[model samples]
Target: MSADQRKSPTEPQRGNRPPAHGRRRILITGASSGLGAQLARIWADDGRDLALCARRLPELERLRDELLDRHPHSVVHVYQLDVSDAEATERVVERAVVDLGGLDRVVAGAGIGMGARVGSGHADVNRRVLTTNVIGTWNTAEAAIRHFWDRQDGHLVIISSMAALRGFGGAMAAYSTSKAAIATLGESLRSSLARRPITVSTIFPGNIDTAINAGNPDKKWSVPLEVGTAQLAAAIEAEPASAYVPRRPWAYVAPIMRVAPLSVVRRLVG
Candidate 1:
């Protein structure tokens, strides 16, 4: 298929969808912690059935237990899948769709970040970070899109970052570029899916205090995970194709970067 063409769903829709009043079924990757975990909690409170995936089995199990305890009637299934592994990711995503009876929404929350000076030849770090943040997110979104196409009524949320708004500086070369790729990928998917019954939401979040940033000592640069996740959740509910989380000073950064000369950004970021 052409890059602009929308791909149809791969499987037949299964089970009877609940009444309009019933909760949405959502599958979220990287659900073991941070914004992913927060999204799971907020959605479960609304009675949504959940299929959560992450590499951390213990954390995923904990989230599953918590969700079940909070919403006794809701079904929360946890899968140990790393989105970077294409075959394994596809298999587990297929299972999540079947077990959840089909998905009404998907949040591709799996990603990684790294910063240690690009030319310093942090080869291993750069490679691993790109694999996790870019390709891993791609894998998750591709799987989710297939399921959404079959259901013909669902939203795909792609979690990018404010760093994506502009190519960052200092040691963040690889990390910023990877996130920018995800943001652009989501934007393209949004256009392709517009004619279809499916919706694509691209979220650009600012400095969320997730484990992804745990290595960074600059705590002042980060905001509470809730601040970012809450904004993202609201955008998901609105079903917008693109959003800038927190929607304030952070949102302003994107336009500034877009309009400002690259030299200015380089000076500031450097």
Candidate 2:
């Protein structure tokens, strides 16, 4: 089957779930740059309270100042944190929940990617990508889940990738698997929390023009950083279980992988 043949996330029907209010407190990880930074700006511009976290203190401080200057009435809290460390992740999240008086949304956006062969004796690169992309995301999501469980009203936006549409080849083994794990994690959470008021949306974006792709030869999938971020924010507002942003292109790609023969997939990956 081609990607277009697979199921897509449609608008939720017959429900009165309203979009999160502009004043809602939102927590975003990896907010130092790229998509996370864009999301932070988008939320801030909407007049929402924000808790931004990343490992870089200077960048976080500058972003905080920018947001505060732009939206004086909006509360912007900055935390310099490494989400890969579970303890630190917990501490920062605790402060965010308390300082913001409970989070209405959490964007688990802290992730890393690589273009190295797995098991090529590059232990450092493998560990860095896996830790930041998968484990870090897990830690952030777990913290958000706990907080949302308590409040019973919140949103979780987990960012996966289109590379995850199939096992990534061309020097992306670990990166692809990590994203695939993210997609599954979001799906599992969606199932587990079906009865709750919390909404979980898993976003699979195509090639976005971020630092992640900074040094690579330009590819056809590139979309500006803002485009992907805006699509994500819109997806959050739409509140579906899963979505392929820049839907026209990737919506066709996702389903095709599902029914394709294994050999064909391998060849495609090659």
Candidate 3:
């Protein structure tokens, strides 16, 4: 709720967490590609054990083998998870926690960027986006935070977006809406759990040419995949209530987007 809750370039606030390079157990949803996959690589290289989940079991296995091949000592388990299925999400998360012996962090990173114009008669696309991005995230959060609640210790990170600072129209409508909801959800969780050791963080990533953002209008300015996720891993390590990946411009740009005139917004984003 306070302005300081959003991290600044220097001295970003952190929570009770493992040491910067400590080896710990982490679980990540949507680990098949893009941000999730890259984050796995970054952390694996740091010697952390991981539980990687996504709809694509094959890709998960491939990533698991690759990480294991590179870091022979790290333990990586892959689970086929479709976070939209609440029951399955709960089951798989519990199982993954069991497999990993325990969980130290969970990243609810599963999401889709599909959308349709409000009046375009493509209700199905809009529904899919809301269900996958919003509901799917909620399901993952529900299961993960429940586990953390039991121990009164853990970190939950939601991958939000800079798009959340505004309500985009056209193909970005539902995606932006979902990200806005995620930001608010992370803030609410952080507030509710303030008295506990559990740390809830929200990461607002800038444009990257990931599968979910094929239609991003700002794609040309996208940070390279490895560069963006490396920044993401650093921000997550800090465990801020909220953060912008590659904080230089976004740490400044996000605030302006929140209050800028719609005309200016249209010219900049649309």
Candidate 4:
């Protein structure tokens, strides 16, 4: 079967019905740049309606103008949102659903990648990472779930990381932990709503050449922004329960990390 033809764990039985087609209404967070922006573009190319939000309104507006220019028929709405604020997240989600008419899928993609070594006087960095990655994801998921449950059908796409596969030391510790928590959150929702039409997909992405990580000297095994986001968009359309983008190495690497020695894992991260 084609990649998009594959069914997710929470997808209804094959004979029951097929996946939805035509213009999809999608809401994406952290869409100012990086993977989030690319995903929006991919969907827009398919003439999909989108509600995009990020802390940066100008960036979102630029994206909106670009999308409108490219796909005139597509409806694109931009909102300024900081997913870390639970109340704001909920309000924005509700408004987006209204503005877009309805939401078929919601992508939790807003996240930060700050470095702070353990026991280093920089506990603030760790706290910020946790708040933005974990709590922010939860806030987005909570809002999406309530709306999806009411409609009895929707897809929730959580952007996790390959770092979630194993624990890391030093600066990566908190970030790794946050990714793991969100992955678990997606899985838990997937299990709970298995019998329902609501689908939850957790995506574990490897190093992608986004603006956030552009300066990192270690570009080892990293895919370009376009390639990574294209794969992500395909996976989201497929609605897989969980996936590793540019799956080649990471799909195989994830399991190895789970069983590898602590020293080996440390070296791998370093």
How far does residue 153 in candidate 1 sit from its true spot (Å)?
Answer: 2.1
Clashing pairs in 1: none
Write candidate 1's Cα lDDT for 79-174 as tens digits.
Answer: 898899998888988987777778888888887776668678777888887899899989988888887787787788888887786777666777
* Candidate 3 ranges with C-alpha deviation above 4 Å: 1-23, 217-220
Question: The CA-based lDDT of model 3 is what?
Answer: 0.83
Q: Each model's TM-score, in the order given? A: 0.85, 0.86, 0.90, 0.89
Candidate 1 off by > 4 Å: 1-23, 214-222, 261-270
Model 2, residue pairs in steric clash: 2-256, 3-255, 3-256
lDDT of 2 at 31: 95
Tally clashing residue pairs in candidate 3: 0
lDDT of each: 0.77, 0.79, 0.83, 0.83
**Candidate 3 residue lDDT tens string, 40-80:** 99887776778899999989978977876675545677889
Q: Give the distance in Å from residue 215's predicted Cα in candidate 1 to where it truly belongs.
A: 4.7
**Candidate 2 — which residues are off by over 4 angstroms?**
1-23, 261-270
Clashing pairs in 4: none
